[model samples]
Target: MKKLNCLIGAIIKDQNWAVIPFGNTILEPDDQVIIVTIPENASKIREMLEGGPVRTNHIMEE
Candidate 1:
């Protein structure tokens, strides 16, 4: 199994536009998120979050 460390945050949508809150934010309806996840489970995580891929430069060593 792989471990992913992600900063789970949220975003809001309004009038065909989207916004992401900053600092000590709370989740709201239509809020999106920015998260970091492992490459293997990235796709599934994205689907769950209703978002897209997270950019990563590090890989896990076994």
Candidate 2:
């Protein structure tokens, strides 16, 4: 089984809110998606979602 990490959130559509799960489900442009994916696939998921990882100042702070 593939382990998927997902973000639980609601999306507003036409004055209505809908719940979405991060998986193989189809998503609309105006729909809020909860990105659920595995650790190994995290890089791919991020790339697909927000184009790329958001740079943080604490990345190398440790």
| Winning model by TM-score | 2
**Per-residue lDDT tens digits of candidate 1, residues 1-62?**
12223433333245343333333344444343444445665665444444323332232322
lDDT tens digits, residues 1-62, model 2? 12224433444567685764655444454444344345666565454556323221111111
Highest lDDT model number: 2
Count clashes in each candidate, considering only residues at least 3 apart in sequence or on different chains.
Answer: 2, 3
> Can you tell me which runs of candidate 2 are displaced by over 4 Å?
1-23, 51-62
**Backbone clashes in model 2, listed as residue pairs:** 5-36, 5-37, 6-36
